[model samples]
Target: MFIAAYVLTGCMHQPEPVVTPIQQLNTERYMGTWYEIVRMPTSFQRDMSHATASYRLNADGTFEVVNRGFNTRKGEWKTAVGKAKPIDGMPAGFSVSFQWPFSGGYYIAELGSNYEYAVIVSDSHDYFWLLAREPRLPRWLIDRTLARAHEWGFDIEQMIETKH
Candidate 1:
């Protein structure tokens, strides 16, 4: 009875998984183009394919974000320009605004050592994206990155791979 009770208590005391963002993000090194490898679906990006996000650092330490993608149904390319500002005390956190007076959280939760790939998540945890420097990533790498997202308590079952 004691052993069973102890097991139940342990099971109830499991710690919540924490999302750890990168500690030191070099904005200079990160300034470039990144192809969307996979993402959790959202209305804003509906029917988007060959999606890519390009970043350019401004002299005042802000970043210009240009998100481009092809609309499969419309047979045309779409683009949105936004501004990103670093969040104080959060090395990998930024507030991105595409429209006036409206912004959203953009956090670099996980990144490759050489900045080859990155896992992005928002404050709501509903938005997740996997990005890479190149359009195509190795199958093994995709699998591994998805596994890591799962470990971080994200629902990876609905992740959709982007076509590039």
Candidate 2:
């Protein structure tokens, strides 16, 4: 009994698996600018703030991805232009190329009913970003978004709030 109690108390809790991408995503409906609200610290976005992403569907069925942010240290805006190609059979999944010949997985984990907010996660399980159509989301919407993300097994505690 003591050993069982100890095990129960000391064991690490596993994070639940995330749900599959939404049944269908209207890529056209998702195109536009989105401000980053929270995200994981990563080399790509290090020391940046006021981050925003824009998407534009191309005639070739690919999409343009532009990431712009202000470097805190330099106090200047920096931009990275990338391209995204949809992964076959996955409505919300894309392979994004920041440079030629190299692409990484991008998944739309969650999207708001009106396309007002989105939770994006990398296939590597290493990157996450909470985005909104506006620079800041309403408190209630933020709470609702967080609750939904928590239910889907995202570690909310690991999120770093993005300063605008």
Q: Backbone collision count in every prediction?
A: 0, 0
In lDDT terms, how accurate is model 2?
0.70
- Please identify model 2 stretches exceeding 4 Å from their true place: 1-19, 147-153
Give lDDT per model, in order. Answer: 0.75, 0.70
Who wins the TM-score comparison?
A: 1
**Candidate 1 TM-score over all chains jointly:** 0.86
Candidate 2 lDDT by residue in tens digits, 41-103: 676677889899899999998988888888888888888888777777778877677765555
Cα-based TM-score, every candidate: 0.86, 0.82
Expressed as tens digits, the lDDT of each residue in 1-164 for candidate 1 is 00011111112121211365678999999999999998877766778899998999999999988888888989998888888778777888776767655566677888999999988876554577899999988999999989988887778998889998
RMSD to the hidden true structure, all candidates: 11.7, 10.9
The window of 10 residues in a row where model 2 has the poorest summed lDDT is 1-10
Whole-structure CA lDDT of model 1:
0.75
Instruction: Give the per-residue Cα lDDT of candidate 2 at 84.
Output: 75
